[model samples]
Target: MIAFPDEAAGCPLTGIVASYTPRLAALAAEPGFVAAVDQHAAEIRERLFAQGPELMPRPLRRAELTDYALGFLDALAEVGWDQPVGYDYAVDRLTAICWLVHQNGLLDA
Candidate 1:
């Protein structure tokens, strides 16, 4: 498992991933998975912005936010929870998410 900095653990992206990854892995091919991705991605965007510009990197860009959230979701969708590979993939995705959020300069409250 990826260990996010204590600060970033509360982030909504982190929340969504931590909460949904297992479910997603099990349901990736299910009918509503695509909708769920969209819904969660949107929620991530809303929550991120709600954290305020003061908490984010200066000159925040929308593109990066979308890319990271979507990419994370896509990663989760690619692996099955029942497979050992899925565990590794989850770790990798978590790592990427932590790095991206930090690289973008989001500060935890």
Candidate 2:
């Protein structure tokens, strides 16, 4: 069994999806980022959550979570989703999502 000290053991993908939603919302509010990001990411992101989030064996610290969220957002900025990016971007997104879950925090911070 997993034991966290006075903390929630949340799912990482959910946090990323939540965070992505807000960023997407804000970006959509932008002049052209919306169509660009959507045209770029819609289908690729569909595969992002295909099997749900893969959790970490150990609980994450707040800083770790923040780093993860940044990693994901960075991947979005760098990859935009449809093109071929190095696997580093994929690793960042996946790790960041799992970290977000462990921290029980959204990508907002």
The C-alpha lDDT values of all candidates are 0.46, 0.42
- Candidate 2 Cα errors over 4 Å, as ranges: 1-11, 42-109
| Inter-residue clash pairs, candidate 2 | none
- Per-residue accuracy of model 2 over 42-93 as CA lDDT, tens digit each: 3333433344366423333455444444555455667565423322344334
Q: Give the runs in model 1 whose Cα sits over 4 Å from its true position.
A: 1-63, 82-87, 107-109
Candidate 2 structure, TM-score to reference: 0.28
Query: Which number leads on TM-score?
Result: 1
lDDT (Cα, 0-100) at 96 in candidate 2: 33
Query: TM-score per candidate, in order?
Result: 0.31, 0.28
Write candidate 1's Cα lDDT for 1-109 as tens digits: 2222332432345553444445545445754544544454345555555565566624445355645555655555665333344334444444344444544554333
